[model samples]
Each structure stands twice: as C-alpha cells, then as structure tokens.
Target chain A: MVRQERALRTREALIESAATVFDRDGFSVASLAAISSLAGVSNGALHFHFSNKAGVADAVEQAASERLERLVAAHGEAVGSALQMLVDTSHRLARRLGEDVVLRAGFELSRDHVRQGGRDLYRQWHAWVEEALKRAEGEGALNGIAPEQVASSVVAATTGFEVLGARDPKWLSRRTVTRFWQLLLPQLATPPVLGSLVAAGGPPGDHARRTPGGSPAARAGEEDD
Target chain B: MVRQERALRTREALIESAATVFDRDGFSVASLAAISSLAGVSNGALHFHFSNKAGVADAVEQAASERLERLVAAHGEAVGSALQMLVDTSHRLARRLGEDVVLRAGFELSRDHVRQGGRDLYRQWHAWVEEALKRAEGEGALNGIAPEQVASSVVAATTGFEVLGARDPKWLSRRTVTRFWQLLLPQLATPPVLGSLVAAGGPPGDHARRTPGGSPAARAGEEDD
Candidate 1:
C-alpha cells in the first residue's frame, strides 16, 4: 500500500512538472526532459508513467477537466438563484484560472491543434454554462433573453478571459469578471430579479475565497483530478 | 518601375509563404528555410526581403492590420447607423478569417506569447470595437446597456470566435457569427433602432460576400493589403 501511494505521488509530481513546462512553453515546444528534470524523476520513470509527451498532456487535460467539473458541482450545491450561482461561479473560475497553472495548461493544450482527442475544456465549459442557464430558465429567473444565447455569450466571455489571461494576467482577475456580470446581469434579468444578483463579488452565501493575486502556484481552489 | 514592382511582388510572396508555414508550424518551430522553400525563393533572396522569421511575421501582421483598418474605414463610409456598420463589419471579418490564410496567420502569430512587442491584434481589435460601440452611443442608438460593457462582450465574442475557429472552422462561419449578432443586438439597441440591424446577412449595401465553406484560400473580401 505504501509503495502504491508512492507511485501515485510520483505520477502526480510528473503531471505538475509537465503543466509547468507546457504552460511556459506551449505543447509544441515543451520537452519531456524539462518536465522529468523538474519533477526530479528519471527519464525511464517518466516513460513508465507516460508513454510520450501526448500522454503527459492528456493527463494534464484530464486533471484540469476534473477540477472544473468539481467546481461546477460545488457551485450547483450552493443555495441561491441559478443566476447568482453562475455569477459566483464565474468569479471562482476566473480566480482559480489565475492561480492554477495546471488548469491553465489544460486549456492551452486543448487549444493546441497538434494535440488530438483529449478533454476539450472549452466544449465542456460550454455545456456546463448552458446547463446552468437552462436551470435558471426553468426557475423562471431569466428575463426574456434566451438561455442558449446567454450560454454562448457567457462561454465566449469566460473562454476569452482564459485566452487573454494567458498573455495578460489581469484578464483573469475577479474585478474584470465581476464587472462583466455587473454590466450583463441588468440586461439579462427582469427588474424584479436584478436586485438579487451580485455583480462585483459573489452570491451572499458563496464561500469562494480569493487567491493571492499574481501567484500561479497559490492553488487556493484546488482539487485532485 | 517594372523592377520595383517585381521586388514588391517577391516581398509579398515571401510574406505570404512565411504566413503559411508559420500558421502550420507555430512561430517557435517554423524555420526560414521552410518559408523560403514554400515561396520558391533562394536563401539570399529571402534574407534580402526579410531579416529573419520575426521580420517575416511582422510583415504579415502589418499587412493584415492594414486590411482590418481598411475594412473598418469602409464600414465607416457606408450609409447607415454605426450599429449597423459594426454588424456588417463583424460579418466581413468572420468571412475574411475563414477565407484568408495570411490574415488568420497574422492573428495566430500575434497570439504567440513568445513573440513580444509585435502588433497585438487582439488589443487592436478590442480598441477598434470600443470605438465603434462608442460611436453607436454618440448616435444615441444604444439602449440601457453601457457602451463599455457592450464593447467588452463584442471583443470577447469575436476574439473567442477567432481562437475557436483555429481549431474548428465552423466557429468562423458566417452563420455562427450572424447568430451571435442576432442574439446580442436586441439586448444592445433601443426598440426604434433594433429594426435597422442585420444579423444573418449583411446590410442592404454591405458587399461582404460569403466564401464557399471549407475553402481557406478563397479571398472573398480581399483588399490591396
């Protein structure tokens, strides 16, 4: 049991190392040697865990997807209107993206044209956002706006934040995303529901703790894949 | 004059070739040899026209930027509401992105985080979009939604389309972009002006022709850039 635990730990270390290198130098240029060395593992061990660079990337993508799934699930469990949950969840996602390199690398790798057949983070997020908005629609919390339209815009904006944040960290800041909700919610909600939405921070019961700004390794909202 | 024209053509050819290779193999991995070979130019000829790969990429970006500038200018000259102009311009851009490899490559190259200080296509697009929406506000065509918020969402959606298009061409299709505007415009415009906007197709006078789907090299909106 101890040996099995150690093997799992080594694999986790290797994935973390791979995320670091892939995040810095995109998938096409990142080297396995760099990842193995950063993990303090031998090349033989790295090969044993991952057959190739694509395998490492697949692992990273899977881990990130799992993190996102957990985030969505947690937000769903929170008590509030679905719209508020979405607002608060958007804040958490933006903050988590700013803090976690593994998540960032997963998104970046999915965008890589060379990498094939891995977890498509963008599509997954799109479906989740659609589901959340649909739930809001079911609750009659939405204004006249169509759920699918709102879903598309939300996915585009959040995904754009991730893409832009890769170049400028400020795009991932809670302030930017909050401002997004602030501007969009009034238009999206009927007058009666407008007061119920929180744009600059999160829902009243939301326990989303902010990560320290500018620290990629902070991992405040982290979870295992 | 003939000699000068020939030199200009050769330089254009080199930039186009560089864009092709750089689009296929990213900026870091693309080699000058491949670019020259694709252009059918000798090594010395390629060097005479461009100092290095960065030089080639800069040329492509400048050309694409000029094309985008001209597009905005044309839309500005058209007779209609600024909101209509913005809608028509977006349609043109989505079509151009589908048809023009050089323009697409220019955008991809600008997104390369490793390549610093070149023209930031995303930022430039963001500013131009903000200006257009501000103009719409100046014309008093905007509804309750703030111009800045509309600008932010437009940039995010269009830029998201571009990034997503890199992986799937369907994202850049006129149908997809048109659907975006159709969904977004009602929320952005006052009731009186909403009727003036065109979403699925171009404005009455908009000459933004559609390229047959699945053809990357068909330059439907080609200008002298």
Candidate 2:
C-alpha cells in the first residue's frame, strides 16, 4: 500500500506540473522534457508514468473532471432557497477562482477529442445543477416555468462563471456570485419565500459590496429596474 | 492598395490555416510546414508572415477578437428589455458555433506567450450584460435586485450555454438558446411581456421555435439541472 501510494504521488506530481504548464502554454508546446524537468523527475521516470505528452494531458483532464465532480458534490447537501444555496456555495465558488484552468481548458480540449473528459465533467455538473433545480421546484421556487429551463440556465451560468472566474477572481467574487444567485435563483425559488432570501445580508464577507455614494442594496435593486 | 490587399490576404490565409491546425493538433505537434501546406502557401511565405509560431497564434487571437468585437457592435442596436437584448445576441452567438480553434480555445493557450483572450472577452461580455441588466431595471422589467449579480449570472450562463452548444449543436440548438432567453430574459423584461417574445417565433425571417423538447434539449435540461 505504501509503495502504491508513492507511485500515485509521482503520477499526481506529473499531472500537477502538466496542469500548470498546460494552463500556461497548452498541451502541444509543453514538452515531455519540460514537464519532466518541472516534476523534478527524469525523462525515464515520466515515460514510466505517462507514455508521452497526450498521456499526461489525458490524466490531467481526467483528474480535473473528478475534482469538479467532487466540488459540486461537496455542496450538494446545502440545497435550499437559491440565495441560501448560492451563499452556501459562494465560498466554494470564490475559493476556486482562476485556478480551475485545467478543467476549464479541458472542455475546449474535449472539442478535439469527442471522448474527452470535459464532456463528462460538464455532463456531471449539469446533472448536479439539474437535481438542485428539481429540489427548488418541489419547494415551489419557480413561479410557473418549467424546471428544466431553470436547470439549463443555471448550469450554463455556473460553467461560464467557473471559466471566467478561473481567469479572473474578481469577475465572480463572493458578493458578485451571491448577487447573481439572488436575482436568478428567485426565478426558480418559492416566489413568496424568495423575498427573504433575496434580502439576506449583503454578501456575508464582502467589504466592497455596498458600493460608494449609495447602498450596495440600492445598486442591486437598480439592476432589477 | 492592391499590393497591400494581396499581402493582407496571404497573411490572413496563414493565420486561418494555423488556427485550424492548432485546434486540431496541440501546439507541440502542429508544424508550420503543415499549416503552410494547409493554406496552400509555401513554408517560406508562412515564416515571412509570422516570424515565429507564437506570432501566428497572436495574429489568430487578434483576428478572433476583432471578429467577436464586430459581431457585438453589429448588435449594438439591441436596446429595451435585457431579455430582448439577450435574445438578439443569441443570433450572433450562434454564428460563433464551430468557428476556428482560436475562438474555442480563447485563453487556454497558456503554452505560448499569447494572452488568454478569455479574460478580455469575458470582461467585455460582463460589462455588456451589466449594462443590459441596468436597462432592464430602468424599463421596470426587473424585480428590484442588483443588476451586477444578475449580469454576472447572465453572462456566466450565456457563455456556458455557448460553450456547451459549440460542443454539441443539438445540446444548444436555436430553440434551446431561445428557451434560455425565455427563462432568463423574462425575469428581466418589464411590463410582463415575455409571452409574445418567448412564445413567438424568431425575428423576422428566422424559423419558428418548437416548444423546447428536441433530443438535445431533453438531454441537456435533464442534466444541467
């Protein structure tokens, strides 16, 4: 078991190194020698683990899919009002800002390889988001629309948010994410109960939330106009 | 001007060819010779136009940006309900489906020295979304919430939808996109008038939309839950 664990660590090291380089250069130009050098292993060792560049990339893509699936699952038990669920998922969302590039790029890579990990990851993510919408619908969240519509919109929003956020943390900060949830989730939450959830505290831990010269809440409300 | 036009065409040919090659193959294996041959130009011509492989990628990135910018500007006349604006943008968005590798990769080319176009593109998209949300508020289409949040969510959702749609046209068909507009835009449209827009056919000359249950839509909504 200990030997197995060491072998796994070497494999993970190669993947981590590959993710960073691929996130910077992509799988094509990032050479095996470079990846091996970055992993502090010899070419022979890298070859032992991954036969070549695509082998490393394939592994990285798989790990990225698995990690994303785990993240969504971690937040699975927190389903509630859109705002509350978003808030619960807010930190999880914010924490991953910009570093989720491996997964983000994997989706694009999937386009090239139809059997790529990006497709599977998104499939899983959409499934998770769909489940959330159904629960929200059962709770009387959507006013009168199909729960499917809400699910599609939410999944799209989450994937887009992650891709953009992985590139720029501020683009999908805690408050920004919460604010998004408050507005859109209301469309799927119990209509009467949405008011309270939407009115929840101004993005928990954000100091810059309120904006200047006017309350942040007012600015948010202005958007609704 | 004739000489300039000829040079421009050759340069464009190089970039276009290179973009296709890179999309199909990673940076490491996509040779300039292959790219040149694909464009029906000589390797010497390709090298003269782009001093380096990275130069070719930069030009492709620039071209993609300009094309995207042009598309957005063409839709500049989109005003009134944020929802309508969103729906109008879908037409433009649809055209990007199955475009060159550069548009799909956007920023995943970290291997080269090129900047990730994803960041700038997303920021621009977010700003545009934010403005539309504000307009929705002014028209009294919103439910008195923060536009930034809604904007982020809308931006996230739209980008996500487009990305997913690009991979599987069936997953994000014209109807699926319209459904997205129907689901999201109504929440932002004022005077409670999504009935005609959502249920109505596409803009003049566009096809009439089916009521949301194609194989792709069915599969998508069920998972993006």
Q: Which candidate ranks first by lDDT, i.e. highest?
A: 1
Task: For candidate 1, write residues B1-225 as lDDT tens digits.
Answer: 999999999999998888888888888888999999999989999999889878888998998888778867876565568887787777778778877888888888888876764787888888888888888899888875567767766777787888888878877776566656655676678778877666554444565365443122211121111
TM-score of each: 0.86, 0.74
B129-169 per-residue lDDT for model 2 (tens digits) = 67766776776666555676567766776677766765576
TM-score of 2: 0.74
Q: Model 2's lDDT to the true fold?
A: 0.59
Docking class of 1: acceptable
lDDT (C-alpha) at residue A196 in model 2: 52
Candidate 2's displacement at residue B145, Å, is 4.6
Residue B19 miss distance in model 1 (angstroms): 1.7
Task: Evaluate every candidate with DockQ and list the scores.
Answer: 0.27, 0.38
Chain A: TM-score in each candidate? Answer: 0.90, 0.74
Report how far residue A152 has shifted in candidate 1, in Å: 2.3
Top candidate by DockQ? 2
